[model samples]
Target: MSSGFDPLHPRELDLPMAVPLRADGALVDVTSGEAALTMDDGKIFAAPSDPAQLDDWRAQLVSWREGARARHGVPRRYDDPASAWAARCFTVAQVWLWDELFFDFDAQRFTPERFLADARERFGGLDGIVLWHAYPVIGIDDRNQWDFYDVPGLKQAAAALREMGVAVFVDYNPWDTGTRRAGDDATELAATVRRLGADGIFLDTLKKADPEMVAALDAARPGIGLEGESKLATERIADHTLSWAQWFADSEVPGVLRAHWFERRHMQHHIRRWHRDHSEELRSAWLNGVGMMVWEVVFGVWVGWNDRDSATLRRMLPVQRGLHAWLVEGEWTPLAVHEASVFGSTFTHDGSTLLLLANTSDADVTYRPEGVGWQPLHAGDTADLITVPARGIAAAMQVTGTEPAELDAVRTALAAETPARDASFPHRRTRRLAPQIPSRAQLAPADIRAGATVRTVIVPSGEHVLTVRHRARETGMYDGAPYVDEWKPLPPRLHDQRTLERVVRLANPVRVGVAEVSAAEYALFLDAIGEQAASRDPERPASGVTLARAREYAAWVGGRLPSEDEWQLAAVQPGFRRRVPEVWNWTESEHSDGRTRFVMLKGGSAHESTGSDWYVDGGVRGPEFALKFLLPGLGQDASPSIGFRVCWEETT
Candidate 1:
């Protein structure tokens, strides 16, 4: 590992954080607080203790921005109205492209409207959505990243999201070198962006796209904002309109986000993907006058948001939407309120002011703004003190002289409504959807009855507790989140090999095929059904078959794909054997949590992508090993390294 730069666990010194303002009005570029892996894990922002001295600190911040502009020659591209949407996007969801909420697996179609509705109810609504495709599934096949985006209805989905006032972003994986060779990444990416008419590019595993890439993507289409994965470079912030805070630990006083502070229009989204408690990230976003990356499903494991955070988001979204000008372009006051674990910021534009409050403590804190005409926009309806719940957020608005009808509508709607008190995490656990197969055991295959018996091994009917081993990849085996409230998962724990115990029961004896179905066998089955399929070799094991298609072949053979347990049971039997050039065997252990769907594969494949722990684990392995492969949509699940075996039930 060159430089020992662990993406899962980044060093504080290597991270860029909120620039703390020294007491003497000098900006100190500290790497802690608002930059640490979690809240309070590093030094706090070195600002004046007294709120009265904030004016000087604010002045110094402005001066530093001016100096940095001259030092780096900041073009301030945010001035262009073409990418104005980036500035106004307060909430952007990093949704798995095949997330059940976004795509209906049953219907085999994109459901953008359904996805948006969930966002509206649970987390107010989305301003932008990054369709996270490929990664965790990419290295499975030779098809590169662009092929995932080039899905049949991806453009339509992007158009639908755009028409609904939600900006759409496509994820660009720069580490996709092992896949099929394609045109230059820049050219291919630009073409994909142009074809999809995307509004932004989410730079996967990149702090900033290289200058050449930036230029190519810029020329792809107008208003194409680029969002880096982690804390973006200081100088690049001018051109890259957006980036998010990952594992950022804020000060007791909630330090300013450097990017947003340096340029008011430069949007910074706060995200801690693996953590279940989002209060810290939300607080950072709230104080920074920035956005939040709503990632319910991290890769494939579900680390969904809690009720309190979602409610907090719901409370502030209306105000943020109605007073977008004040929130993004208005004068920003960091630490506007810093009393007893409660911190906030004030944004004023024209005659309207919006106060965004966050409570870090575990109890409600009631306090009214220290001025008249402060009306609650997300808390108590009246002009009285509003309550900011424990580890929650609240908001209030003030009209300087006159109240605009639009602002009045927001106030009226959120007036008097109390914040949701439930801080319980809403978890989604994946469960195996065991399909019932029509037993055709009365007679063997026609060829077998005709003296061409296929080799088989039997798994007796009974409960068998099996020990299954798999790497602790993000695509967790079976169910439960891989990381819960974890700020950072390092080596030995991040991708370490782990074991699971599964007790499987079979109602009747199952006869599993000794070898994977050959390309010739699959071809015959298809031709018998009046269909055509591509096969590389007639004698080789059938590969590049989707889970659905595999199920169809198993059914056509009067059988079903073996579950991981059954496969394991049959593997150790004397008669069972693997086909030459082994591939992952499809199992009936298909699972879903209504948001993500995954399948369990047995008998590891020979194909493995080197250079990244993010790639699916590979190499030939025993039956004890299980691969929890996430099912991608639009024929992307078909991989040359994946195939299936047929199994049938034994009867009297």
Candidate 2:
């Protein structure tokens, strides 16, 4: 980073996501900066709050749309009949493939039904989900990004999700060039998509796919939607039907999402993964007649939705799912009615008008628009005025020519499902698994060390504060989001070396192994226990073992895996040593925030993948350096670049 680069306080990221159209026929040029970060929306956009300025603003907006379409040749959303799913995909979610809610660890199966059931109950249901498989955990070994998706039964999981009417999207890590190669990326990705029967591909890191990738995916699945992570270029919007509206800060008077406004059928799923308050994003999506990305578990961190946002999503989904045509094809008007803190947008089509209202204020707002025969879609009885919940949204429809059956179903569902008023942030803390101190742990250090399998170092009992070093990736180690409300975390704020202090408490002395358990020793243990151990080197530390396997081995020996604290404490001891080929050692500090599971790893491996910042903790690291590894499902936790050290809580 240069002398003045401050990633957290990037001025450009704080700007509005909507382009401003001044009344004086002047438009800001939005295509100045890098194509990935810059879109149709100029960074410093200001939406008009005064009602009188809206018409001219809208006229300029329309003119810009016309000019942009002319400048950039049309692609797919306009005429392609096959790419119609984008319009109806109002609500999508991004979930880790190994999310506890999605995968059954004990059953050893993908619980698609359970996942879908929870979604239906909480946020009505999901139209699609991005099964985020790799990156963050990638570069752990020689296994490339594709290997994560190549897990056994993964195809069956995708098939099951599709069977349940939920579209499955496989994530593509474009920056995964340094890891193990499986043919070329395009070919490997398309083949994986075809084999898994995936409907879409989530492009990680990139805003849009290159022509070659796009062609490859199109050949594999003709209508496969390529949804990018952040902003999508204007030219690419024709083909990439979906865009992720991540970290897009809207104006006080909600501004239209640039992509959605440019092409009505283009789906922009509004999401701020780290933000605790989703009311703003939900409201913005509602008024724009666009989409919302429900990301409860963001990169193995629990940033789950509150009751209020979930209820709001539930209220909009029923109507949006049914009358998506109105949102995409109808006449859309933003800021149609301005009632102080309450703002609304009206969508009209076929003698019917739908009004989506959002109250940005803290208090409940009542608005009486000059209208008749309005059927409330927000579960409200209004002879005159309708109440839009505080910091929430509401919708109502007036059908003139033959009331639609879809509207009736929507109304019925909306009436039954009451919206919640509570907008409090739902916080879930990651709890560390309790360590079972065996009888021998309390004995003198000499007694515990006498029969140890390897050289051991004692971590004395007491309160000790130690500094832990980690890279500030999106998976903020054991806490809230690292980037709250900040847009597009840059290199300085992301993947930067940061440290935090951990105050550890121990009741008794524990002996941590000086060296990681060797393969020969592990094979011997397996033989004694009548367990089959295969493909062992005999000399190297036991690698490619799961946390469960490591724990089981420790238990059999009347000991346990060392907690990260103990490992760090014993690392500087005189007898502590590392094997010839170093590998990350799994610790007992496994934690769960209910939605996601992660464990700590001490030391670092030499198997560092080059070419991308998305890889796991790499290079030979010091004792204090720890990696927060999110546990993967489908027996994928057994990584080759990882080994273990036992902390003896030896039994009598």
Candidate 3:
């Protein structure tokens, strides 16, 4: 007895089946003639013709039930509704299915029975299953089904799967299948979904479609798991939108089955080509959006050497487990997107900021976070610093008030001792000069307060060495003399119009190392050097060496490198600064390049003339060239300009 409702109009009354019974209790007349079959609930059974056949049919039903019980380790009695709504995440192979049409039922490779069965057996306790229906060839000629009204088999299959606690979702196509006569109504498909009793639908092929369709679907089911597939503008999706398909078929929504398990070729294609190609455009479109963008990898099928063992689905358990919270429950915001060398992204959630720093450069690229206060945390090292090498991806989460009290203590100590320095330099400045030669001044350490905080040692009273270099002259005996001799003719040593060049070296180099420098400082440094350098002959290069050398000097003076976050925070100061380019500072991060691990150096090098190129903007190197430092509060201070500063970690 097929136990499901017969197909009828919504206004029509239901009818009973007219199946004949056989003497042997079997369904004898099933294949002999056309019979009015009935579908009561959702179960299908044979309608017997002879009395004997009817009896045999009953026996068969009992045997089938027993077999099902033995196979699934369930009681003979079935639960009412047979299905439960449990949340779960799953991946689908829509592309593979579309590519390999009409899966070979007998071959076992194409059938989803085994996969679904295994999922239920393994993770049946979850809340719901997310199915990714990524069929790109829906409207194609050979598979077009615009006029075919009934797909009762599909509905039955869905129901059967649901009985075992699984939900069914079909990938919805906004555009008509390519062959469906140009303008097929999309609403008809929505009607199909309703008819099929589908739990939800994933929206795909939303290139230039009308927003009304999305609105319509939203109106149909406000929280019905609406996910967008492939290059769909997330901003355009409604606030209740479930997920964004990032990468090729990747889903931003967590708790759904991921797609593309064995499709490495496709994975590389998106990572290397599509994402690489349209990153800029996509980023520009998402500028006004919120947190880090989530993208999908591959969903359906498992990995194998060749395509022979498709049955064996490989699991990336570690990544899947680690990302569970973010994918399933975390809120995200898209920060910034970069093209070419680095696949950089920033996401923040619940006061925690996550920076996805991927090095796409042939050579390792180091990224320093600028504009936010952060401390580096390592897996084992006590240093509040982190380092990531080339060909690597670093998942850096900003340390907030949630950090341990021990960490807070260290930060507080550093904050108490470090002086508040303003790294900002305005575009224009009044030049101060001396009328008379200024004598060399060296302040004693005794005159300076050891624990006093100062913006710059030179700005306030401090022990510093004032170096007065000799000036260059084009003629005469006194022309090339030191400024001291040139100002011999003037009475007062200080004058409003005179420009005096002075380099102050701290009597005792203060420990001043930040994860990174501020953008304002970076900009100021660039401008200061530019103006000073430009004042000389065009053919002449500045004599003070490069920014790279300055960094090296800072390192030599006892300060360590700064991470991108530390640098960005320093640049912004009272507030956060956006973009600036100075010397790329080295970070203590180390990462793997398939075979080896190294560190990343943030900011651009002196060799990089422009700050715009993604390649030169951030660079990385191996540990061989990386500089090391004691953990914060270890009493190690090393750079003249590479001083260390402390930041207050916000409580969550």
Candidate 1 lDDT tens digits, 1-652 = 4465555544564343343456465545433334222312222243455677677666656665666566666655887889788988989999888999999887789999999999988888899999888878877756788888878888999999999999989998888887788799999999988898889999988889998998998898766799988777677887899987777666556677766776778888888778777787777777777789898888888888877788888776777767778777788877778676787888887877888888889888887788788877764445778788888777877877887667777866566445676777777777878674433334436764332356788899988999989888877767787876665677776899898888888899999899998998888766766678687465689998888888877877677888888999999999787777889998998899988988888898888777667777778899899888888877878888998888888887
Q: lDDT at 330 for candidate 3?
A: 39
Q: What TM-score goes with each of the models?
A: 0.90, 0.91, 0.29
404, model 2: CA deviation in Å? Answer: 2.5
The worst-scoring run of ten residues by lDDT in candidate 1 lies at 35-44
Per-residue CA lDDT of model 3 for 1-652, tens digit only, reads 1234221211112111222344474444332123211211111132333333434544433343343334333321112122111112333322222112212222312333654554333222222233333222121112233333233244554555457554555565444333334334456556655665555555553422355664565455443444444332212222222333333221111111111110100110111111212222122211211111211112211111111101011111112223333322334332232434444334454555544444433354545565555553222212233333233333344656574333343333223221111212111111221112112232113312221221321112233333222111110011111121111112232111222333433233232232333323333334533433222322222222323333432333223333333333244344322112223343433222111112233333233212111111112221122221111111111121132222222122
Candidate 2, 529-607: lDDT as tens digits: 5678874675688988888878766765657898889999999888998875899998998888877778999899978
Preferred candidate (TM-score higher): 2 or 3: 2
- Scored against the true structure, residue 544 in model 2 reaches a CA lDDT of 86
Q: Among these predicted structures, which one has the highest lDDT?
A: 2
Q: Which ten residues in a row have the lowest lDDT in candidate 3?
A: 260-269
Judge candidate 2 against the unseen true structure and give its global Cα lDDT, from 0 to 1. Answer: 0.80
Which model scores highest in TM-score? 2
Error of 2 at 141 (Å): 0.5
Please give the CA lDDT of all the candidate structures: 0.78, 0.80, 0.29
